[model samples]
Target: MAAATFIEYSKGTQFVSTHIYGSWWFCMLWGALAIGTITYIIKMRMHSATLLLLHTSFIVILTGALITHLFAIKGLVHIRKGITTNQYIVNNGKEIKTLPFNIRLNNFNIIYNNGTSAPKDYISYITITDDKQSKDGYISINNIFTYNFVRLYQTSYDDDGNGTYLTINSDPYGIAISYTGYALLFFSLIWLLIDPNGSYRKLLKSPLLKKGMLCIMFLCGFSSVTQAASTLPDISANKFGKLDIMYNNRICPIQTFAIDFTEKLYGSSSYNDYSAEQVLTGFIFWNDEWKNEPIIKIKDNTLRKYFGLPKYISINQLFDKNLGGYILGPAVQEYYQGNHDKLHKAIIEIDDKVQLIMSLRHGEPFKIFPYGKGDNIIWYSPKAQVPKSMDTDKAMFVKNIFTLLNQSAHSGNYNQFNSLIAKIRIYQEQNGGNTLPSVTQVIAELTYNRIPFANILFMINITMGFITLLYSIYRLTSIKNNRHITKIISYTSIIIMLLSFIALTYCEILRWIISKNIPMANGYETMLLLAWFVMLFSLIFYHRFKILITFGFLMSGFFLLVSHIGQMDPQITPIMPVLSSPLLSIHVSIIMMSFALLSLTFICGLTALILYVTHRIKHDEKTIIDNQLSSLYLLSKILLYPAMSALGIGIFVGAIWANISWGQYWSWDPKEVWALITFMFYAIVLHKKSLPVFNSPLYYHIYTTVAFAMILMTYFGVNYFLGGMHSYA
Candidate 1:
């Protein structure tokens, strides 16, 4: 499956799906596994219903997949407005299939975000005619239309909105079986967690495990230094930042926009002493001076050397005065003409940065002045063209508002500038009205931006986490027993972590309120949520497994670090219509929680390995090392039951979501394949009798430590290296 993902990138989904996943050999492999599982269950005389059902569910799911591969008819159909279509193309356009009913596209509509051109949803109204009987229905992203055992999903639409394209699936038996399997899997997992006779429960009841748990319970708890002052006039930039504007398909405070804009251009939200708002104000009011500021970051060494530019280059530096044109103009042209080598890609990237700065200089992103009424309202920048039908006075105000504000700022007339801002706010309220975000939401977002808790908390978390981890290890290893002092230190660390977790939770709530959606839509948001889950789980289980608190701090801190690394956008924007389902929230939350558990297991494995390598214990002290290793292995085993189950459940939940949104349960996308691989790879540790090596503490820790690589590949590697539909996550 892993190899298939990379191969699919080159050969396309159809080729890989046909030759790899859908091949006879793949089906045979699944058949062999199913047969082997049943044989093993019979040989071992396994009678636990939850365990039997859990293993049986995978066989059923595989059978469903095989049936789907053999019998499902998946295709696409494009229907023009007022035209009836019964034929669809399938098998990568090699075969055509006819539906039992004719679908006539009655209308196609693109629903836009309030005060913005960004599409919120695509709806296609259609009438299905079958045997002289007709039914009217609508198909949308997550809302599918079914008729005569056929499903139609909204795929795309014509640019002119006169036609619509939909994905068609006719797989009644396969989907039914697969969904049954999913339901069984879910129920069995829940049952296993609570089952009195389950391995997990049995292990927990063991005296050795209880004694080990009790024995360990006491140990529980910059990019650049550029000092460039803002050149904007000394005015209330904070007030300006508070004003609401249409940005990135949603209405948010300009404070959010300013922070994102500054970070995009300068690689940080602040430049020396000036705030993001101040820096943005400078660019809008003092374009010429700001253009010469060396704020644009060029991280590519080769690209920098090619242009003979510094690490951070000014907008003016990108313009070749000698040639009287943009320096990257010729390179960009070559890039468009199919010269897509590494250098060209880098050139295009730098060109995009330059273009962003140029857009700011032209005031293209300042869409603050709302005009028109109802659903037709549009937020217009000063440079945007105004309709002639608009009220003359309103149109004039929209055109001259920025110029007036600039003049007031240049003249240092604070009163006039403030008044102008107030007038614009009034104008927005009048035009934008209820479509605009509430003042409270605006204030919350502004406060959220100002806190920067993720930035500050990450550093503190890592520092305190390291200290606690080392101290805990020392206490566990050394003969010294300074219980009083260690207890004080542990409590202090716990208090700090509790405070940090509260702060993170508060910020997440504020973000959720501002976006009006769960904060699991993108990589940055999901990473933050994952960090929160780690801390949450740690706090929940730290009493029993005290070292988890230290691991939690380190893991959460590193997750935050990954979120901030590279070019992650921290902006809270609206998610696509397909992602607006409640199932998506549940799916991502479960997955993130599972990841947190898996992360703790990895840390346990690492700690055990460190003990094995760092300390060559004498015969007298061998018992201590063996006991510690045994405890670590037990901790990992306890974590694996839930971690593996959650991962399996999360994957299937995601499949259900995909089925609802895209007319297919599994597309074998790189992320999906890698996730499956991770689940199966880790499943080996659970079968200790079959894989007896895992019975040994040393081998168990080694296998788990290495098994963590699959988790990393599934989460990070799939996003960065193996691009897929789930890359947004």
Candidate 2:
């Protein structure tokens, strides 16, 4: 599957689906697995209902997939408004399928958010005419319409909104069977956790485990300045930031725009001693002075040299006096023309920043005044073109607010400046009406922006976690331990981590409330959620496995760090229409939590490897080293059960979501294939009897530690290298 992503062998022929997944060998492999599982269960007389059901669920799911591959009819239907259609195109237009009924598109509407042009939903109203009767139905992104075993899902629409494209699927039997398997799998996992005789429970009951747990508890004790100051009044700038504006197709405070803008150009939310608002305000009012401040970050040394610019190039420097044009214009044109090698890609990035600064200078991005009415309302900056429908006086006011505000700031007329800000707010309220966010939501978002909780928490977590890890290691290796000191350090570290967790939780909640959606829509948001999950699971199991506390802090810190990586944008934006489903939230949450648990398992494996190496070097007591290794191995096993189960359930839930939104349960996208691979590889560790190698603690630890690469590949590699349908996640 991984190889299929890179090698486009037999390009555009459905090579992967036909030659790999749908091949006879693939069916034979699944058949062999089913037979092997049943034979093993019978030969061993395995009477555990939870275990039997869990294994059976996988077989049933595969059976359903095979059924779908063999019999499902998937196609696309495009219906123009007021037109009836019963035929659909399939197989990249190589085949046509006729529906038993006709579907007439009554109307197609692109629903926008209350005050913004961002589409909230795409609704296609249609009348289905069958032989017996006719029925009216509506289909949206996640809302599917079903009739006579055929499902219809909204896929795309004509730009003019005269027609819509919908996906059609007639796979009743396969979907039913797959969904049944998903349900069984979910229930069996829940039962396995509570089952008194389950391996997880039995392991907890073992005497050696109890003794090892006590020993673990005992050992727990161990552990930019360069930019010139903006001359703008900080107070007024901040006050201006409170006023609402339309940004990224949503209504938000100007502060949100400023922070995003500043971070994009300067690589931080603030420059020198000025806040983001002050810096941005300065740029709008004092473009000549601000443009030459050399604040824009240019990280590529080669690009900087080619342009003969410093590490931080000013806006003015990007325009060459000798060339009489933008320095990057030629390269940027090449980039647009599809010359996207390493250097051109970097040029495009710098070009984006340059373009953003230019936009800010023209006041194009500062859409602060609401105009028009109802769903047609548009926010206009001082420099934006005014619509003819707008009242002449209102349009003039919208175009001159920034000019007046700039004059007021220059004159240092505090009262006038304050009144201008207030007037803008009032104008927004009058025009934006209920579509605008409530005052509380705006305040919450402002608060979220100011705190920088993720930034602070990552630093605190990494530093404190590393300290605790060192102390824990000391306690582990030391023959004579200071119990009093260890307890104090352990308790202190836990308290700090507890506080950080609470802060992170508050951050996520604030983000959720502000965005009006769950904070798991993109890579940055999911990483933040993953960090939260790691801390949550760590705290839950801290007592039984004290080492988890250290792992939790470290993992959470690393997750936050990843969220801050260059490619991951930390800005909070509205989710796409397809992501509005409640199922998506549940799916992402479960997947991230499972990832957190798997991360902990990796930490356990790493710790065991370290212990083995340390014990060998020191020639430590055989019994003592073995006991430690045994405890670590047990912890990994305990984590594996839920991690593997949750991953499996999460993948299936995503499939169901896909079926709802895209009219197909599985498309064998890169992310889906890699997720399946990760699940299967980890599942091998659970079958200790069949894979005797895993029965050995040393080999088990090594295998698990190495297996973590699959998780990394699934989560990070698929996202960065192998583009897929789920890349938005």
Candidate 3:
């Protein structure tokens, strides 16, 4: 697999590597090993029939794969609309292979999400014809059609929609056997999960697990909060709200609109000093103090130059004070509240008869007919498509905006503009034929508001957890007895983590309510979920295994801090079409859960390492620290199999989803490669106990800690550096 990955990366595309990997020797070696394992399990572990069946499936899969490699015919076929082809290029264009039947492309069209340009799906209408029979069918990324032991998979397309490309695979015998093996493997996994040997089944019986489950249930019980609507501010009243009208392929709330506009305009959704919500409301409502807030923080010198500013400027200085004139020229007057006595607005000077400057609101004003001269000029739609039928509404909207500007310019009283803005919004809403944005706006406000409840809870957990940890350490080291106080402090920190988890989970729920999509679609949301899962694991296993409460709080706090980064801002944006899969949600959630479990083990491993180092340095006999180290080591060992199992299942499930979405089960995409690496690394960690060198608790802790590097690569490294299909993060 490693060699195949290298070849794919260096050579580009997996065609050559696939042929090399499909070699007979490679297939037979794996098949032999699988067969040997199945035989050993059956003969030695007579009582473990389930285990035997599971091992036997591996041989079945290998045998099927070997057969497929030996006999399968695969190539790419590109058929232009209104054109038919029966031959496909094969072996890196070295030759062409003629199919048994002619393939005709009827039409190829891309499906986009409603109201947004994001592609929802790709489909190719096709017809298959032979001398004796003809069939009409279509193929999509996730949907395939099979005829006579041959399969057609939607693969790629030309820049324009005129041509459709598909992968044609003909494997007469091996696919059925492989599918049978896959079915058995899935059933075996399900059986193992429900059987007594399953870690989850045994853990479910523990009181701590029951308590954890109860807390989750109690936290999620009141779901009605998501249903309430109609409380958010008027959509039309907020210019920023109207600016970003589309989200998730539909018209979103004004709050979402406002944040998206600012996020793109300022290149940041929020700041440490001012939340995205505050900046949005402040800008929309035209609150003097809020507008004066230094929300538009500029770090780039080039941006500073672009804005015609010194090193930095506040939102008020740049926009509210009409300082935008320095950069935007005359059009700045439209956005300005008439704060300055003179306007240095820039003009477009079209034909020297008409001078115009664009407004930053939505870009390109409407061009009104009978173009008037000077400041009295009327602008109609830029696209020259303004409906003549609704002239009254258009006139009213323009009239209200002009009135508001006049009031700001002369009387310096902008309060009446609010009512005018509301009227304008109503007219705009009617024109656009959209539903009320109040529900989505309210949810966005709740989510992006300053120092959100989730953040506050995390802060409390971090502070309290640190204090408790310090106090507990003191009690452990000192001769004096302070057991009662330590116990109180420790439990308090645990309670704080519980509160944090609940708060974060509620935020996720609210997001689901408003966006109507699973919140695990992005890095920020996934990290938040990861933190919640970490807390869940700590709570469930803490009492039984003396899992470190302090570690949970610290790790959760760190995760929240990462989530708080401006780039990772939890802004509700539209998700890609490929992400709109039930399997995607399950894949990401499972991967996150596995990472969370591994993170807990990481904490244990680190604690054990620290104690081991301390004992070695002090040359002391076994004491409290030594006993604690042993407990942490035992806890890590106990968790190893569950974490490994989760990682394995998640990686495989993701492959299944990829097969559905990309038409190839294994793409060797960078993220997929790293995930496979992570799985293999964890597998080694889990089985290392069999080796004498790694049998010691010290070596086990060290290996577990070191193995976490692969997890980091799978999550962060693949996301930020080794970009690929999974680069949505």
Candidate 2 per-residue lDDT, tens place, 1-729, comes to: 667655423353277777776688877877898889888889988888999999889888888988998899889999999999999999778888899999999999998887677888999999999889999999998998989888899999998999999999899899889888999999998788779989888877878666666445436762265656345677788888898888888888889999988888888888878889988888887788898887789888888778777888788888877996788899988988999888888898888988887887777887777776667777778887888888888887887777898898778786898898888888888888666888779888989988978778889988887888777766777788887888888888789889999999999889888998988888888888899999998888777777878888888998887766544755666778999998898899889989999998888888788878887898989887777778888888888888887898899899988888887888878888889899989988888877788888989999999999998888888787776677753
lDDT of each: 0.84, 0.84, 0.60
Error of 3 at 292 (Å): 13
Clashes of each: 0, 4, 11
Cα-based TM-score, every candidate: 0.96, 0.96, 0.75
Give the poorly placed runs of model 1, Cα more than 4 Å off.
Answer: 212-230, 233-235, 617-620
Output the worst ten-in-a-row residue range by lDDT, candidate 2. 4-13
Pairs of residues at least 3 apart in sequence or in different chains that clash in candidate 1 = none
User: In model 2, what lDDT does residue 719 have?
Assistant: 82
